[model samples]
Target: MAGKFEISRRSNGEFQFNLKAGNGQVILTSEGYSARSSCENGIESVRRNSADDARFQRKTSSNGKHYFTLTATNGQVIGSSEMYADASGRDNGIRSVQDNAPAAAITDLTAA
Candidate 1:
């Protein structure tokens, strides 16, 4: 099965999206946007930026968990991964995003 993007409204009424891998694991999550259109644009940005390794910023939290953020050409973050136990897992998550995002189908849960 191919990966997919799931868009939904937040409890706060904003919009956000998650990129799920073929096995149904969420590889990346986007920040909340005031408008659904902005959230959709963020998904497109991820599709475009995921192709570039440089667009992925790998980082470690102060407690030492590994994670990564995907950024657009202007340097704004498009999405981020959940904290991983190790760098290897974080790297795998990045690879998953790269492999899956470009052609991922969008499932808009926001629609009634």
Candidate 2:
């Protein structure tokens, strides 16, 4: 099945990209991005790729649930959230978190 992509700006004023597969079933997401290009890059990469990835700034456990966090290069906590399980959950949650941020600008498809 073909996948879908969504882009937005986060509450913390960062860029984010979301990917959905299986006809609207979200499959992967990216953390709060510091730049618009980065977010779009992430989204496009997900569209062309098949792997699932979660880039967390910190790993912690709280309230009987595991929490994942994403930080900007400047040390700001742009995105912080929790996940129920392992990689899959974390990856989806990451995208869920991305929903609040602005969509990164799309890049050149031919660029290397």
Candidate 3:
């Protein structure tokens, strides 16, 4: 199975998406957007930025957990990883995006 982007709507009626690896693991997730087109644009941004190592920003939460964000060339955040228990897990998430994002497919699970 190839990696894919799964688009869906939040309960509050905003749009969001998840980038899943070929093995079906969610490597990254997006913030809510008011419009579906903006969500799609975020996905495209992930695809474009995932190839660049410098575009990824590794961060730590206030609780000390690690995570990462995929940012566009112009510095916009496109996607983010789940909070991880350690730096290794966070790095794995980054690698997952780097490996799976370029060829990932889109799976729209949003309600009509």
lDDT of 3: 0.91
> Which candidate's lDDT is highest?
1
Clashing pairs in 3: none
- How many clashing pairs in candidate 3? 0
Ranking by TM-score: 1, 3, 2
Tens digits of per-residue lDDT, candidate 2, 1-112, equal: 4444566677897767555443555434468778877766665544332222333453646555555655444443433454556656755665553442333233232233
Worst 10 residues of 3 by lDDT: 103-112
Predictions in order: lDDT: 0.97, 0.51, 0.91
What is residue 63's positional error in candidate 2, in angstroms?
A: 9.5
Residue-by-residue lDDT tens digits, candidate 3, 1-112: 7899999999999999999988888889999999999999998888888899999999999999999998888888888899999999999999999988888888889755
The number of residue pairs in model 2 that clash at the backbone is 10
TM-score for predicted model 1 compared with the true structure: 0.98
TM-score versus the correct structure, for each prediction: 0.98, 0.42, 0.92
Each model's Cα RMSD: 0.6, 8.8, 1.2
lDDT of 1 at 42: 94
Cα displacement (angstroms), candidate 2, residue 55, comes to 12
Question: Which runs of model 3 end up more than 4 angstroms from their true locations?
Answer: none
